[model samples]
Target: MIRTTGLTKRYGRVTAVDGVDLHVPPGVRFGLLGPNGSGKTTLVRMLLGLVHPTAGSVELLGAAMPRHAASVLPRVGALVENPASWAHLSGRANLRLLDAAGSGGRRRDRRRRVEEALERVGLGGVDRRPVRAYSLGMRQRLGIAAALLRSPELLLLDEPTNGLDPRGIGEMRELLTALNAAGTTVVLSSHLLTEVEALCTRVGVMDAGRLVLTEDLAALRTPTGLVVLRTRDPARAVDVLGRAVVARSGDTVTVRADDPAALNAHLVSSGVAVAELAAQRRSLEQVVLELTGPGADRVDPGRADRAGPPHQGDAVPVRGGVR
Candidate 1:
């Protein structure tokens, strides 16, 4: 478990993380999501004591960070930014060296740890191969194996599959999921929305250096929008829509209303030929975009007054970070 209260960091005039209060309970594949430069890495670094925060405090497990970073880190595994590995060393050799530095007891125990880590990340067969000779996916796996060398109870992963192919990404997901299921508590930061939706049970979304939303993935997915309609008379259809919040563009109309069946039936009976009627929900990426961008100021659809656009700011979504 990790918790931060009012955690903040500043460099000159720039603020990387601002007033973020986060609570990550145990046994969760927690996802930290942000646009590029949104301080995901800065927050992670501050948590691990790689960078000191300007204010606030961090607690890892049950102990305070920075003050107890020395003792607490041994129980945590982290792969942040780019992984460091000796290119000339074999996969097993790299892990062996790391395991030697952080022994779990006997030499046999260390070796077993190394072997199990390699197998867990799908690098056991290639342990004998030099890291330079391995593909990007293999090298990524090797870095993860190094992190698991200590059998850490918590894993902090930042873009764990950044350069990997699709298959490699899938493998990384499975490995991380297995680690969490076994009670390791993995904290993941990824730009891949689908990846987060699939692997993370809970998520904390950051925007403009602020922690905007932290909730269970199921509850966070409640916003549905854009009921699409294709009718013969676009103008008449708008009136036939009654008091339902509606948006019209040429022959197509989109409404915030949830029921398409009643609306379709009304339009048909009113002599307004209906071509297509579909009620669509926002995709995970779309939801994230709305939550982080200027649309964050928009009201809920149920409160929408037919004055707001169907969607906004997503064509060229805000891509800047706090730093």
Candidate 2:
């Protein structure tokens, strides 16, 4: 569980995170979504006490952050931006060192903990090669493994599937689902809309450093009072539906109907053989695209020259254009 109120972080004249009030309850997979430099990473850092807020407060697992980070952070696992380890050391050696440095567990059990963590991240069979020799995906798995060393109750991950291949991404999804099923709270920040749609129960959207929207994924994707059906008799179906028909292409017909079942029954009764039918629902991509503006990484000198200087919360234009 995590909570923040009026959380604001500023770097001189620019605000990275502004007036954010976030609430993440236990037993839910929460996804944080935003474009690059939308203050997502900054907010994550503030939650973990890695970045101090210029104004407002942060609470992690019922305790104030930084103030109680020592007592609370040990029970939480995190991977921020990228994972780092001594390149010359073997994967096993690196994990052992991390476990030894962290709190909890007896010294004798450190090896078992490290091995278990590695296994959870699909690195159980890794050889004695130094971390520098590991592929990008391998290093990513290693970072996740290190986060699991403490058997944390809460996992706060940023770009969790960054370097993973399709198979590795699938494995990470399964691992996170299993962890959540076992009572660990999971929160992830990612640019992958489909990944978040598949893995998260709740979502929070950030734009221009503000928490623009937060809602249950199911609610956001609710039926749009329209039914799309594929039929052999598109012409006849269109005739029967009349004004209700909104779109048509080949065998598919989109009709403005509140109930797919009712629409299907009527179509069948009228001799329209329906092949497939379902209610129209919004995709996560649509939801996020509608809520957020262009990312901070995007800069157009011509647009800036035309529009003049940016307003308070607009993406600051780079003088020389995007690098």
**TM-score of candidate 2 relative to the true fold:** 0.92
- The reply for model 1, stretches above 4 Å from the true place, is 223-279, 293-323
- Residue pair clashes in candidate 1: 37-321
Provide TM-scores for the models.
Answer: 0.75, 0.92
Number of the top lDDT candidate: 2
Instruction: For residues 136-210, write the lDDT of model 1, one tens digit per residue.
Output: 777777777777877689998878887788888888889889888888999988778999998999998887678
Candidate 2 displacement at residue 76 in angstroms:
0.4
Question: How high is the CA lDDT of each candidate model?
Answer: 0.76, 0.85
Weakest 10 consecutive residues of candidate 2 by summed lDDT? 314-323
**What's the C-alpha lDDT at position 51 in model 2?**
73
